[model samples]
Target: MFGIDVRTARVVWTAALVLLGLYCIYTMRTTLLVMLFGVFFSYLVYPLFTLAQRACGLRVPRTLVLLVVFAAVASIIGLVGLLFGNQIVAEATNLGQQLPKLLQPGELERRLPLPAPLEPLRVRLGILLQHLLEGGTAQALPVVRGLGTSLFHAAGNLIYVVVVPIFSFLMILEAPWIESFLASLAQRPDGRLWSNVARGLNDVLSQYVRALALLVLATLVSYSVTLGLLGVPFTLLLAGLAAVLEIIPVFGPLIAALTIIAVAVFSGYGHVWWLVLFFAAYRIFQDYILNPWLMSEGVNVPAILVVFGLLAGDELAGVPGIFLSVPVIAALRMFAVQVRLHRAARLNAGGAAQG
Candidate 1:
């Protein structure tokens, strides 16, 4: 083999195999993403699955229980979408059609007035916003030029929407085997490390799912009820949008608030000040109180670390990176803690042997 010794030949072969594996992984990254999303969804729904099975009692077969629960979930989602999806779509379409006209030069300025002292700032903000929108549309044009132009992306998105849930269901069916497989990969034969890993992951994952559910539910209910009480038009649409957007970190809520206010301004809603006040109060509640309380026992991460993770993730992998950043961080922290514990245990054992 090109004059290489046997050891060198083995090393080269091993390196080649490693590189080939990496290349294969890179090539199948998109499919891997879909599978990963399926797994993620399964994690979110696992607690619910457990609850459903428990409610079914021991007599009911587990697979049957899962099938029934899955059906119920699908039905509920379909019903809700049927009842509200059209209205939401219509509102979105109207907004899309009207926003360009509404954002024309001075239109925004005329709609949103400020005190004389801040009048110059208002004009500047309007100009800046127009420029941003123009730039954004220009950037987005290629991604959304037309159905024909974006067919591949459209198909990929369809795969995400349609296939992901089915894959998640399949993952749910194989959850126990998957967990065992994961545990078997641990270094310790006694399984203590795997136990810690599994328990830590379960805690964080369940808490994440619970926190997300609560945040979305609370946002939708509070926004809809309060806005409806205050006679806000498009209450359902706005509330639903905010609820859905709650899944995305930081920027999502900000965008929701801005959109709500913008819509209020455009629609001549007299309670713009009240809407602003409500959003500010709700934000304070969400940031300083609600989220902290929900996730305190789980990740318990500092806000600064989460911010850094988000920045790095966004830079490295864009939207999916942002979505996975927190989970990865929490998992890493758990792993670090476990490693420390294992090291301390080993040191103690060695010390006792010496004694």
Candidate 2:
């Protein structure tokens, strides 16, 4: 189109395809983001599907198998929610009650260790807090009002919980058809290119999901045990928080630890040292042993790259980006590898014929 010959037309078309991809990403950003989450959740629950199929002797219909898995997952979530609903509500209420006091500058400083140099900073913080309580209240009034609005909106998340199962069921049932459709779109449908791409995607996603599941389980067990021993209120809620944060990669565990520490400190726990020790131990264990082992087994994405992806995703798509960035990058990486391999195979075949 830009004064290009027939051969150059192909190059231009490829560029156009790239630009079209970028445009699609821009346009379907939210839908694609939600679908990516669906895919991840699908991957996470896939093992349960496989197990169910095997348990049913693999003769049961795939649809039935999916339904069984979906039911099992729903039951578990419902049961847990029912069982811990009161405790979670109580803990949340207690945390809410303590938040104002906890946010006081001197309160945290008095309970937790602070650096010697930060004493002067603490005084400044007190003054700042005083000013905030006075002049900043009016300025912050909008934020308070916005939070109320957000709370109303957040109540709709139950709809998402209902929607997820439906999405997962459709994806599982039609997964094969979806793959076939994608393959049909490729330039050479029968080429090894698509096979390699599919294999790479499967391997990366499955491994990542498995490793992540194990890490989550480990975090839940570790945190639950520690909190139980330390006699922390809301053990289940805190452990659940740890498990959720464990999805964030390296930084997740640190945030979880800090959150646990903060909650424990504010809850007026008698043995804060035990809480601190619990956090420190888990942090060390996760960094030194758990993460290394899991990353080596799973996606092999570099820590720095992961951090950058998280930051970029958070900026672009908020929490969804943080959760999906690694898997999305892994998928893209798989695609690139397939393309490169296809080109290399063609070049090798050409050289072999000449030789």
Candidate 3:
């Protein structure tokens, strides 16, 4: 009775520690999320750091490489701001001024031309709009303002903006040490089964992240250049916003499209039809051509699983979680497959021994 089974005790201890750790994580999830974003940002920029390091004959430390990369990115952003910052600020101010008028009960009636046959429908819409403006708008305005404020607040969070970069830098600087430790773990008897699993996860996640970043960057550049050429108001802001939203799954693109179309319509942009056609064509091109070339081959996650994962992630942690969901699901699948293979091998070995 006093003697505990070795395996049972081990399992009990492990389970207790895991549960405790999970509880801690649940409580501190917001902090963990900021760190995770730092990790993601590091992953995206890592290849550039590696390239710069190699170009310096590997004498340049990763820390220096990271700093240089960050500086370069900052310079580019600053230059762009210098070029178009005033335009963006002016457009944003104009939009802000216009929003209240647009939300007025009669504003829609004035802007939108309804057919005589739809007069009743128009009247109903006016009533609905009046309700929204009179009662709901007060509530809605805070929510909208909160949404924007929360986004920038997260970015401006002292811990996020400062500590995250430090964490990212440490992670980058100590990556080799981390890999060595993981490799050492793999040498342990219990870890043999997971050695390949670790390596496979690294490969899969690295490739997926790099590809995804490239896709986002390509989309941003395409949107900015094309929209500018087409004389879209707030080209930089809209394109940048679209690129950020593109990181989210299904609903993101739709929201961006609707927002842009609404602006075009209300602003009396005569090229609204052209804008629609261009967006339609670009959507087709991206879905059929660009996505296949970049992502459709490598990840190969089932459509249903992808949808479910996105929904679950969105439910869990909003947009950032949505961004994390795919690679995480893919990694879990790889682990499951590895475990199944290992279990099969053990069973086969047992059968052979019996024979």
TM-score per prediction, in order, is 0.82, 0.79, 0.82
Query: What is the number of backbone collisions in each predicted candidate, taken in the order shown?
Result: 0, 0, 0
Q: Of models 1 and 2, which has the larger TM-score?
A: 1
Candidate 2 or 3, higher TM-score?
Answer: 3
1-355: candidate 3 lDDT, tens digit per residue: 7888999999999999999999999899988887877777677768877888889876776677889987786688689889878877887889878877776657676655456888768767777766865786678788888789988887676666777767777788888997887899778867867787887787767777776787678778988998888887778778877777776656677778878877765565557777788779878987778777776443657778888999999788766678888888888888887788879988998899999
> Which whole-number lDDT from 0 to 100 does residue 223 have in model 1?
97
Candidate 3 wrong stretches, greater than 4 Å: 2-15, 59-63, 103-107, 113-139, 148-156, 296-300, 345-355
Q: Which residue window of length 10 is worst by lDDT in model 3?
A: 291-300
Candidate 3 displacement at residue 285 in angstroms: 2.1
List the candidate 1 regions with Cα displacement exceeding 4 Å: 1-22, 116-152, 156-162, 178-191
| Candidate 1 weakest lDDT stretch, 10 residues | 142-151
Candidates' C-alpha lDDT = 0.81, 0.77, 0.77
TM-score, candidate number 2: 0.79
RMSD of each: 3.9, 4.4, 3.6
